[model samples]
Target: MSLLRIVFKSLRQHLLSTCITAFSIALAAGLLMSVWVVREQSRRSFTQMDSGFDAVVGIRSSQLQLVMNAIFHLENSPGNIEVEDYEKIKAEPGVALAVPIALGDNFKGYRIVGTIPEMFTHNEYAPGKKYKTAEGRLFDPELREAVVGSFVAQKLNLKVGDEFEPYHGLDFDEDHAHDETYVIVGVLEPSNTPADRLIWIPVEGLQFMSGHREESHEELSAVLVKFRSPLAGKTLQMKYNQPDGHLTMAWPIGAIVAQLFDKISWFDRILEMLAYLVAVVATGSILASIYNSMNERRREIAIMRALGARRSTIFSSVVLESASIAAIGVVVGFSIYLLITTTAAQFIRAQTGMVIDPMEFHNVMLFGPIGIVLAAALAGVIPAMKAYNTDVAQNLVPVS
Candidate 1:
């Protein structure tokens, strides 16, 4: 019989243990690949995030908080800037566009942002990519009409002409819903940005919503600013980012978002270490499974030796068996990776409107599986050496 046939026979004899060990290896490989892909893609996506504006002007607070609140629709506003402050920022030198946004309410947990019609009509969220509606038209600036983003519409099953009331605050509360009813006039096309998860209304609609305190009506959450030139941004950054200034301006939005990942880098490192530890444990399981089976296989090894199989042949078979199991695990691991990444992508899209492309090829995908196979093969060396040192004469003697 061929050496591969011999290896197959041995594997079949220990099929249950083989399958279990291979499954452990698959889990390890899948987890490692998933972590690396998420880490790299998240860093890339966040560091390059764009939100139609060059800078955000708000009440003096953390720049990261301001960007997250204004651009990403996350967290509470630092505090409101005055209407006069908004107008002043708009009139500043080099300011090409300044749209005031008021944020305070949500519809079924989806944020309801209030901004001018000019935001969708004039600005490009991405270069050459203006916000377009898949259905109906932009909300009228003077009316209580809304333009829902594609993601929010899909999740809420909202359509044009459908009227809904806004709930007070970012968190949903059925009892605290405003008496004001707003009609959905448009549904925005999916832009794969944070805007896709927002519900947009006229700035007055949010600021003057029924039950809102009168003081809140005169306040603005932040002003989204677009500058005509880079020098203009640097000039204004110095103007607003002063200790005596009441308003904070966050320029270069991407770097502000990138700081978030930098602050939480330690948590990322923890996850990476856990993944490596799991992989090590899984590799050790492969060694233990094969090593513990060696005692039972010694008589078989002796017989194969008696049948003229070379010692080197027995050794190579053990190593090949280990490699073959790992190879099978690598194949199965891809399925696990697909399942995890697909679920993660959906959750991320729902929460942040960012698409994570699992199909995108990364170097880790190429090397991760190969490294596991090699490690498994190396783990087989001790057992292969045992097979190599088998004494045929002693084991071949008949037992009483």
Candidate 2:
């Protein structure tokens, strides 16, 4: 039989051993792939959703919370500020535009925003594009008309001309539903941001529904401001830090990204450490298996040598067997990785409303398999050398 055929036969006979090695390698590859997928998707999603506003101006709160509430619309605002204060900031020298946000109430945990059409117009998300309505039209000047985001529309099965009563508080059933119903005049095209998860109405409408009239000091959740120049962020922050200032100004993009990674640093580190540990264990297992199997194959190696198989051929065959097993492990591991990531996508979206694309391939994923293959080859070196040095003469001698 050819050396390749002999190798195949041997592997088949040692099926358990081969399978164990492959499984070990697969686990390592799968974990690494999963990590790459999550990291890449998060970076892409955050970048895409956080383009327009340079800073978020809000009542004194955690910097991260301010970004979460203002840019992501994920958390509640710390407190409310007067609309007049927002107008003053809008007129500041380096300010390009200031968009006011009024938030209170929810439809099944998703925030409802009250703002002007400028909130959509001035947004920088999905650059070079504006918030387009997928159906119907934007909110009209008339009170009680609103626009629903695509996610909201799909989840609630709402369309243009449909009317729904807004609740007064966060809970779906606890708070009293607004006595007044709001007509869904429009449904916004999906921007894949918090915008897609919110119901938007005219600021005046929200104020009226909440009982805040123009004559009184009406409070706003936050203000999103774009800068005329990049340097304006630092200058504005300094100016807003005066003791008399009741609000805080922050660079949304920088602050949000930094604080996000910072909070998750421990989790990231744990994953990375586990990945390394898995890799080491996989290599050790493969190496130990090959080293142990060398003793049982010694007589077989001697028989092959006697049959005219060269030392180089014996060595190459052993190395090839290791390489084949490693390759299979990598393929199996990637399959498992794909399965896990795809399965969790929906659950992740439901819980966090963050979309995760599993099939997206990155260059980093290639390294896991390559490393496994190299480790497997190295693992076979000792066994391959022992096979090369097998004593054919001694093996051929009969016992006295």
Candidate 3:
């Protein structure tokens, strides 16, 4: 028989053992693939979110909270600061631009952000390096018209000419509804930042709707400040706070990314530990299954040896058979993992407002298949050794 035929025959004789080995390898590989897909997509989403602005200035509070609230629209704002304070910073010597933000409402858990048209330009978050409306026209400088984010429009099935009543606060209760209504004059294209999930309106309109005018409103949510030069950030930060000021400023990109990683670090570590544990257990199971099958195959190995097959040939054949089973298992496991990831993508996106593409592959996936094959080869070593050292002469002699 040819070498390939010999391998197939050996596997067919121990079909149960081969199946068990393949299943274990497949399971380990699937788990590894799922983890890699989730991690990589999350990183991509975060990187896109981080590219919008330089610094976020808000009420004196935790720098991380300001970033989470302003950049991601993930958490509630840290109270509010005076609009006049923001105006002062906007006119500062090194300040290139300052976009005031007024946030206090939500439509189905997504934030409504009130800011100037200049915000889209200053932050470079606009489409095609310039702000352009995907539907209808940009918000008129007046307070009654609003522009909806792409996700908000799609999710709510909203379009131009739709009228939406603003709520008094983030609460969705009917009682908190504001007296004035907003006309959706425009819809923004997907920018893949907080902009994609927010409802944007003129800052003056928010103040007018909220009934704050003349005197400085004590509650301005946050401000996006751009410096003339990168080095201007440190200087502006010091002057803005000034030890007694009611506002604090931080680099939004750095703060948001840092806090996100910090928050997920423990979870990532747990996942890593679980992955390693699964891999080790899978390896052990594959080893045990192949080793146990050796005794049942002893007569077969002896017969082959009696036919003038070299000891080395018998050892190589056994190891090669186990490796092939492991390889097949890895492929099957990866398919199962893809199915699970694709099914969960929509649910994850709805909960986190973060898009995940599960079909994307990363280099980390290679480890899973490689690990399975190595483990299978290592497991066959002991059984192969036993088969190689078999006493051919004694077996052929038979009892009397």
Clash count of each predicted structure:
0, 0, 0
lDDT of 2: 0.78
lDDT of 2 by residue, 19-65 (tens): 99889988888887777677667756665455377888989877678
> Model 2 compared with the native: what TM-score?
0.88
CA lDDT, every model vs. true structure: 0.89, 0.78, 0.75
TM-score (all chains, Cα) for each model = 0.96, 0.88, 0.87
User: Please, what are the lDDT tens digits per residue for candidate 3 over residues 1-400?
Assistant: 8876898887887788778767877777787777767766776676455435688899888777887788777778888788777878788887887888888776665667788888665567633464557999878767588888887889999899999887766656667777778899999877555576778888777766754444434447888877788778878777765678778886646655767777887887787677667767776776677677777667777888889899999998878777777788888988868876776666656544567777776776787688778887887777778778877766655757
Candidate 2 clash total? 0
Instruction: Please tell me which predicted candidate would have the highest lDDT against the true structure.
Output: 1
User: How does candidate 1 score on lDDT?
Assistant: 0.89
Relative to the true structure, candidate 3 reaches a TM of: 0.87
Residues 1-400 of candidate 1: C-alpha lDDT, one tens digit per residue? 7778888888889999889888888888888888889888988887787677999999999998999899988778899989999889889879999999999999999999999998998899888999999999999889999999999999889999999999999999899999999999999999999899999999998888998989988899999999999999999999889999898899899988888999998988887888778778888887888889989998999988998989999999999888777877878888888888888889888888888998999998999999989998998888899889988888877665
Top candidate (TM-score) = 1
